[model samples]
Target: MSDYLRLENVSKTFGGIRAVNDVSFALKQGEIVGLIGPNGAGKTTLVNVITGVHPASLGRVIFQGEEVTRQKPFQAARRGLARTFQIVQPFPEMTVLDNVAAGALFGGSPEGLAEAREHAHRHLAFVGLDPIADQPAASLTLPNRKRLELAKSLAMNPKVLMLDEVNAGLNTGEIDTALDLIRRISERGITILLIEHLMKVVMSVSQRLLVLHHGALIAEGEPQKVVNDQHVVEAYLGEKFAKRLKEMGHA
Candidate 1:
C-alpha cells in the first residue's frame, strides 16, 4: 500500500534558525506513529509544517499521493487532515456541542447546522463528552477539555489525525482513558501521528516510533528497537534512561 502521508526532506526555518531540518518520514494508512523528543526538538514545528500552520522552507509534504507542501491550514483541513493543539482552545462562550459542531460545519462536509450538530454529537460521544455537551466549554476540567479537543478534531472527519501532547497534564487514570480513546480512533481507520512526552503512553499506543533531536530525524523504527538505539539514547533518552530500561529488561 502507498504511504498515506510523506514528508520528504522537509525543513522549516524562522529567520536564521532552522526549527525543522531535513526531516523525512512516511506514515502508512491505519497505523499509529509516535513522535518523541525533548523540549525544543522542533516536534511542534514539524507538526505545524505538516498541518500547514507554517509552510516548509524546503522540501515537500505529500498527503494521499498529492503534494500539499504549501497548502493553507484550511486547505489542509479540507483535504482531510486534522490536528489538536497541546493547549486546548475551545470557544469558551459556546456550548461544548456547539464548539464541536462548528468544526463539522467548517472543517468537514456537513450540509447544514443540523447535520453538523448530529455529527458533532456522535464525535462528542466517541470522546466521552456527550454528558457535558450542553455545558459551557470553559467549565470543563483539563481532561474533559482535552477530550473536547479530540471531539472537535474528530468532527472534522479527518483521514489523518495529528495529536500534540494530548496527555501532558493528565493523571494515570486520565492517561489510560486517553490511550483507550486513541486506540478506538486508530481502530476506526484513521492514521495517527502522536507527539507525546509520556514514555509509557507513547510506547504502548504507537506501532512505530520516530525520534527527533535538534530539528533532525534521529531514529525511526518499531517502538522497542527505536527506544533501545544508541543514538536515540544519547540524543534524547540519555544514559540514565538506557540503564533503567536495561534494568527493567526493556533492552
Candidate 2:
C-alpha cells in the first residue's frame, strides 16, 4: 500500500536550536507505528510538525497523497488528521460528552450540534466512557481523562490518529485497558502513530517502531528488532535493558 503519511526530510527549529533534524519516514494505512525516544529526543517536536502545531523549518509533510506541510492544525484535522495531546486538555466546565462533541463540530465537515452530540455519544461509548458522559471533564481521574482525550479525537472521525503519550501515567492494569482501547481503534481502520514510553505497550501494539535520538532518526524497523538494536539500546534503552531482555530470552 502507498504511504498514508510521509515526512520527507522534515526538520523543526526554535530560534537556533533544531528540535527535529532531517527526519524522514512513511506510515502505511492501517498500521500502528511507534515513535520512541529519550526525553528531548524530538519525538513530540516531530508530532507537532506533523499536526501543524509548529511548521517545519525544512521539508515536506504529505498526508493522504496531498502535501500539507504548511497546513494549520485545524486544516490538518479537517483533512482527516487528528491527535491527542500528552497533557490532556479537556474543556473543564463541559460535560464529557460535550467536550467530545466539540471535536466533532470543529475538526471535520460542519455538523449541527445535535449530530455532533450523537457522534460524541458514540465515541464516548467506544472508549468506555458512556457511564460518565454527563459528568464534567475536570471530574475524571487520570485514566478516564486519557479516555476522554481519545474519545474526543475519535469523534472527529479522523483517518490518521497521532497519539502522544496516552499511556504516560497509567498503572499496569489501566495501561492494559488503554492498550485494548487502542487495539479496538486500530480495528476500526484508523492508522495510528503512537508516541509512548512504555516498551511493553509499544512492543505489543506497534507493527513498526521508529527510534529518534538527539533529533535524528537512528532506527526504524520491527519493534522486536529495533528494541534489540545496539544503537537503540545504547541511546534509549541502555545496556542494562538489553541484558534484561536477553535474560528473559526476548533479544
Candidate 3:
C-alpha cells in the first residue's frame, strides 16, 4: 500500500535534551495507527514536527508523494493533512455550528456556504453532537468539547488526521464515546494517527502499535505482544506490573 504520510528519521531537540530521536513511521491510506508511551515520551513533539509547528532537527515529512518537511501548518492542511490538539481549541464565542463551519469554509474546500454547512452538519451528526449544534462551543461539557474538536477536524476533510491524546481527560463513559467516534471516523475512509494514553482505547482501536520511550521507539508490533515484550515492560510498565498484566492475560 502507498503511504499517505511518511516521516523519515525525524528528530527534534531542545537545548541538550532530545524530545524526538530519529523517529520514523509511515501511515497508509485509510489505516488507523496508535502511538503510545510513558509521559514525556516525545509523542507530542513528533506530532508538532509532522504538523510543522516545529521544524525537524533532521529529517523529512512526505505527504501525497511530495516532500513537505518545512511546509507551514496551513500548507499541510491544504495538502490533506490535519491535526487536533490534546486540548480542544474552539472559538469559544461562536456557536458550535458556526465554529465548525469555519473549517468547512477554509479547510481547503471552496464549496459554497450551503455546501459547507451541509458538510459540517454531517460531521456533527457523526460525532453525536448535532443536538447541541446551536450552542456555544465552550459551553459543552468536556466529552462534548472533545466531540466538537473531532467534528471541527473532520470538517477539514483530511486524508490523514493526527490526534494528540484525544482520550486523555475523559471518564469511562466519555472515553467510550470518544472511542466509538474514532471508529466511525475510520469507517469514513480517513486514516488516523493517535497519540493516546488510555490503554483500553489503544489496544482496542489500534491495528498496529508503536511504543516510544525517552524519545526513542523501543517496540512496534501486535498490541499484546509489544506490551508484554521484556524491554517494553521494563521501560514503561514496571516488572511487577508487567508480570501481573501477563497473569491477568491483558499483556
Q: Best-fitting candidate, measured by lDDT?
A: 1
> How well does candidate 1 match the true structure in TM-score terms?
0.97
lDDT of 3 at 150: 86
> Which parts of model 2 are misplaced by more than 4 Å?
none
Better of 2 and 3 by lDDT: 2
Name the runs in model 1 displaced over 4 angstroms: none
| Cα lDDT listed for each candidate | 0.92, 0.91, 0.85
Model 2: lowest-lDDT 10 consecutive positions: 242-251
Model 2 score (lDDT): 0.91
Report the candidate with higher TM-score, 2 versus 3: 2
Residue 83: error of model 2 in Å?
A: 0.7
lDDT of 2 by residue, 141-230 (tens): 999999999999998889999999999899999999999988988998899999998888888889999999989999999877898899
- Model 1, residue 165: displacement in angstroms? 0.3
Work out the TM-score per prediction.
0.97, 0.97, 0.93
- How many collisions per candidate? 0, 0, 0
Candidate 3, 8-50: lDDT as tens digits: 9889999999999988888888888889889999998888888
lDDT of 1 by residue, 109-138 (tens): 899999998999999999988988999999
